[model samples]
Target: MSYKKVSLIVLGSEAALKRALITVIIGGDEAAKSSYLKESEIYENNNYKIIYTPDLNKPSKDIKSVFVYNKDHDRSLLVVKEGFSTGEVWKQIEELHKLTGKSTEEFIVVLPLIHEHTESYPFTCLKISNLFSTISKMAEDRRQKATSTSHADHPDDPMKVAGKPSDSRVNLVLLGMSGSGKSASGNTILGKTIFPSKASSSPVTAECQAEDKEIGSSWVRVIDTPDIFDDDINDFTKKQHVNKCKELSEHGSTVYLLVMHVSRFTDGERNILRKLGEAFGSKVHEQTLILFTRENDLMQGDMTQGAFIHSLTPDLKKIVTKCDNRCVWFENKAPSSGQVERLMHVVHQMLIFRNNSAGSWWRFSR
Candidate 1:
């Protein structure tokens, strides 16, 4: 498709932004491109133009500016900073979807990287296919007459919809019972040793700590928090941790990974459900997923992790089933641990499923 006007959204202001409509806003290392730019080997390609910026306030002046995605028939993708809020950001999308006047499914909104991935960003192909495919479909849907494709009209592109989701950020959180490898899981997700944690410890996490990151070309933030029910603390301390978790999770918590130890099921683990009920609600359990830690447990015993769960007491089975049986195992025993992308993919799917659900649709319809 011939295009005259195309905008790329970026997180910062730059000389390169004048050429695009928006700057999909990947927040890692645009300045360091000098290494490759010196060699004239800068890898810059995308289905949609990208304006590079360090923040959201600096998109180009001419193209429409939307801080959030909201509407009907609003067929566009939104690239956001890590830890984006579906509840907070969806207003713009809800508004745009209303404009499209189509079922929520007819127009799709996707957050490709749930966090900032520096190792693979700026020049990486991570999840870009799905992201671009949505834009391509939008462009196809809005394709105009083939005869007059001029700068004045800016060839009828469907991806040129009023508002779209941003792809510049990722949101990942670490949650599990005390001593269930929550901190290590966080470190693994972040690809750094940012937090202090140990296995088989009680109440190591006192509060939530967040660190921004770049996963490849995407921005990600990991928030590691205190154990679900730290018995060591008083009720006041408990409320504080609970409040902090809620505050931190206010945005872009696409999945609730209830990390549990494969070898043992403790009251601490059961307490997590009650705390989740308070933090997010009983419904949160339905959205919650089980992440089994300690890979060695599987190898150390005849009863494999899967078999152990299978032989669980009826109550445990019910508990697992309530969480939709969405579980994955991670061996955090080593760095570059298991199931990072798989975990992210699960979160991504949950966010998409959440968007398509009735609560979101009703907001637009109402």
Candidate 2:
């Protein structure tokens, strides 16, 4: 099937969606043959072919492999078994488009059943029954509209409408050695005291905590994690922390803020990135930004942030270089909204660079 003529449906509940797909494809009376092919992960009959998969974010290779067979059938349905936040769902849609070399209309997003009525979704969502006909009609309407209008006048380009950076959300995960002012920097980003911040020889934040605030047209979720890279932390405990961070960051695009004390780049922090790789995946640095707290120390010494970065030791400079020199300093003691805004701008630009580099349609502006 031509991708331009495909229909995308975002609906509620995986089980419900699957049931509906079976009913539509295999007939409600044909219970004897209503079973998914175990090896191929597909359910098909003479009329329709349905491809089933888990969440899109977790398996790029699998998604790509599945799409290799999508073009064989005219009425194919790609059913995603879980749903993400509105921004994340759109991102997945864009990714699906890129992976399949297709348009947004070629995918179907099945949200978790629990969230059917709780939140406002970015795409037009529907309940389970009569999915095929409903999606077919919608796709036909869109196709007719596209044919009648100029390319610029087509109203259903998902990238143009839903993939704007302003319409998306981001998760800022704070990670670094203990006493690196992660909690304080989190408070600065949030523009209030949400995470606990205080001076002590021991760690203040005993666990991962998250909070969010609206900053103009977007929402920024700040996730403050305890020192998972600490040498003394046991493997089991470290795993727990890492898992918590992942769970909290599961809903949106995550930018890890590697918080550090501006004046103190200790021996422990020298290999922090390596340790971070071991905990998270090796691609952690791709989404990492260096956040230096205690900027007042730099101010007192009349040192610019660039000057400070230029003078970093080889070890610290390697960390900065690995993150593409995307670094920002914060004065947590005297927080300001401008600091947070500037940080978010860097984040926006960073995402834009990544998406554009990957040939994505999502765009961002200052």
Candidate 3:
């Protein structure tokens, strides 16, 4: 999706900005609303949200959530929250990981809200301007794919609704052991030459590379990372690789795109998840979904991935179960046109899983 639609967005802690916006929320003066609305124009209507905030923390929840939110008609929005401290946010998140398991980036956006009419709030002008500036930059870098890429699954209807996502800035991290075509899959998603690839242990990609491209109406970022199972690497070297990739993704990635060649899902392959847990924490697997590549190999080979992963592959199924039965097949050589859209659909559904479980903690595992 093109970010052109949203010119600005503010994400931050509400409690932090509480003292400043309290007066404005309580007074409910028309001038205050008018001022905040005008500032929204500066950002092309940037959306701002106070993450995990208590309704009472600020001067008023209804006063701000419903009123100030509408004043800024630009792409801007004020997100009032139900919780207060960072502890509350993490508590909800940890529980979420428990039930549905944590995805790549659990939460997509966090916006901090600020209001005008802050002459007596001491640093009202400075605080409001700073918060507005921060969100405005984020909003301007945004765009949503306005169209959907759907194929008619049935011959009866030509306009059958295929899977589509609301926001496409979603970044998927292709992680796993070496020689998994993680880089090749990166190339496929990008539809261009970006990351280096070859059948060698050189680890050409010793770091993470974040690249954005327009796919239909959404902007997709395919982050290529160094091998999680680099044998020749030292402990610090592995940490560096993980850190670099995490930074490139800028913490926006919500899906762990595990790209293992369908031909390589062996008992040994099952052990690889351990490295992921080790590298990104055990909870990492909870947010992951296996992305099997070289799908064409399944047809050409004597045995298919599904057939190979029978009762004997309890470990493989264990990994799948950790991620809420989410998985996808991709043919890097001849990728199905719907592959990207399908993966995104899975991502969209994974996001919705959080909403389904309520705005509280959920669990994963036995």
Candidate 4:
């Protein structure tokens, strides 16, 4: 994972560079056929992919033509043979910049394992043996730079101004079958009727809707989504809803509120958690909180939340356990704000525990 995708420009004999590359790839001194080199100019293994060229003057106009760079690797390398002057190295780098239209900072200058050059240049210099570590360091620097630039560009971001890491913002995503009162729960969380909530035999809120509000001095984004888990829906339409939910929840720590009716658990919801995992990822349960709406019904039945949960069917209890028993009941129609405050308290505690246990909190997989 440390190795980056690199475009190496070797200013030395092709044979010497090829030998070095083979050693780096296979990680041994044992000799092997040069057929791998004859096959293509690109050499790769699990750890790294190297697109190399010896002729600096005829470097590819588009590096992508040589090898398609992936998300993890976008750095370049300049391999200087022994006896090359620092001036010559800079000149070659400039030529490379002219040819590839890449900034000199994107290229890491690599010197021979044993060299006498003590003059420092504008680019980072590393021994050939340490090329992988050098590229990893460069990648880390690039990531840090991008983060800093993002903060600078978005100075008005609520999380930034609140002195919290941007990723610490909480995204409360309401998910369940249709008619599960997800929109009502969303309104309860935001303490306002942001999404349309009504008693309907058919689905309401046909698409994903999101609204943001400050909760406990932290910005919380609440997303009310359509019935993405509906078996009757077409695959394409369901995928569209799922993708939209992911897009809205991309920037923050996403906590899926699996809303359900306290009095009624439908057959479709028997496998709701599994369906969510299938749509998102298996780790989705770790960030999920089971939300049972219509708390008045349970109160009317004179059953405590703990007693009700204890009486849950085997399958339903399994889903609850999957979320580590993080359950909150809401009486959306009630005038009291205690229920909403309690929900926020649970969410805040979950966020704090997750942040403490895991260095980085949950993020949607795009």
List TM-scores for all candidates, in order.
Answer: 0.50, 0.53, 0.49, 0.54
Q: Give the number of the best model, judged by lDDT.
A: 4
Of 2 and 3, the candidate ranking higher by TM-score: 2
RMSD of each: 18.5, 18.5, 17.4, 20.2
* Tens-digit per-residue lDDT, 242-273, candidate 1: 67866765654445777788878886566667
- Predictions in order: lDDT: 0.50, 0.65, 0.51, 0.67
- Compose the digit string of candidate 3's lDDT tens values, residues 1-366: 433333222322453333223222221121222223321211122223321223332343322343344433232222324333444544444433343333314322222211222233211112222333444345434422433445345433211213233232567788877788888888887877788877895556777787766554335678888775766678888888888777765534457888777666654467777878887777886568778788787678665444544432577777766665566677877876566655654554455443343211111111
Clashes of each: 71, 0, 41, 0
Poorest stretch of ten by lDDT in candidate 1: 357-366
lDDT of 4 by residue, 1-366 (tens): 143333343332244554354344323223322222322355554333455444454434433333233224455656656667778778767776665566777667766543534676767676543554444345445434545444444365666753667776789999998888899989988888889989989998899999877664457899999998889999999899999999988997788999999888889998888889989999899888889998899889998776788789998888887787777788888836656655665565466555342211111000
**Global lDDT for candidate 2?**
0.65
TM-score of 1: 0.50
Per-residue error for 352 in candidate 4, Å, reads 2.6
Residue 186 deviation, candidate 4, in Å? 0.5
